[model samples]
Target: MLSRTPKMLLQTPGARRGFHSIMSSLVPMVLEQSPRGERVFDIYSRLLKERIVFVHGPVNDDMASLVTAQLLFLESENPDKDVYMYINSPGGIVSSGLAIYDTMQYIQPKVNTLCMGQAASMGSLLLAGGAPGCRSALPNARIMIHQPSGGAQGMASDIAIQAEEIIKLRTRLNGLYASHTGKPLKVIEQAMDRDLFMDPREAQEFGIVDSIIANRKAPQSSGKQ
Candidate 1:
């Protein structure tokens, strides 16, 4: 077994990348020696390391990397357990959020997402991407989803091309939100034009949030591989 380390507390944006990078680098090195049989799992449970992921600030590349690293580590260290991701982010960087979304979809462990405060824009997308009936929010949490925006500099043609790409992304996202929420793309499209915001109950009705959390409860997985 590798040497046990203290809990990595990622309280600041600056600390996230540093912490998960350590886990990312350490996994391959230690996996061979990591116990697979029924051994004490506290080593992985410290700080709820393998079972929980937090998105508490703006979404960005570092946040994406952190979430990726955490998922990768948990996949390697505890593939059978459930992961609880709590999001309280204001959203940022569309590509970063998409990266995190892809990882959440690709990872082996089932992910249950809870919006503890607010999830807007990309954050709302992330919240809706949770595994099946696993999407939820605090009773007072808020959610917002809107068309993505982008900017480009340089040649006029290049700017027009970038604008077209942004429009494409908006279309893609509208369909994605529709798929998850069971709403039609046109409905989502109109709402994005005005920056739709919803409380927990409204979000559930909108199909973005599956349940409004009234207390702490561990969600049951769908048991699908």
Candidate 2:
């Protein structure tokens, strides 16, 4: 029975902290052995304990896939618990970011998004899309939103089709932002016309984040363990 259970599972606050440190130490050695070691040593094992998911670096299909899986798995483990998402991304593929965003909403647990460094473009969308009243950013974090840009080179007709798709996507994004921020769709479109950048205070004012985390600690999760 014990063998059937997860070996890296850490219960209790102290255990989570202690094992997190231990796993951090083990990650380098594990990486030396296998390139895929991060999946086992760094992300999944640590995630199971803290129920925290990090969306670091540029958002892409692979990153989106992993994050979606983690969110679903965490929800499957405990639907009532709040999941914390730490995002520090420069942004990337639109569809990829939307995949993660959709999954965030599909999951039952409330997701609390905290911008660590920057959440620009699609990253900004994900931040704004977090559970209302739960989105936040570090004091120095930057947030940005802008119209989607795409490239099409096959033919003029194809380019026009791509342009149309981009317009539709931009509209969808604007609607989502307006829904989350309580701002009007036209306002969102205007703000997204150019790269609108914001610091924590500005982001909060712009409705990209609910609060600025100035306490230097992770924000509290709303759900009981």
Model 2 misses residue 211 by how many Å? 0.8
TM-score of 1: 0.75
| Whole-model Cα lDDT of every candidate shown, in order | 0.74, 0.76
Q: Where does candidate 2 clash, by residue pair?
A: none
TM-score of every candidate relative to the true structure: 0.75, 0.78
Q: In angstroms, what RMSD does candidate 1 have relative to the true structure?
A: 10.5
- Candidate 1, pairs of clashing residues: none
- Residues 1-225, candidate 2, lDDT per residue (tens digit)? 122211111011111122224334645322324565533354445554688888776676667787899999999999999999988877777888889999999999999999998888878888988998999998889888887777555666766777788888888888989989888888998998887888888888778888777775755332125
Q: C-alpha displacement of 66 in model 1, angstroms?
A: 0.6
**What is the Å distance of residue 26 in model 1 from its true position?**
24
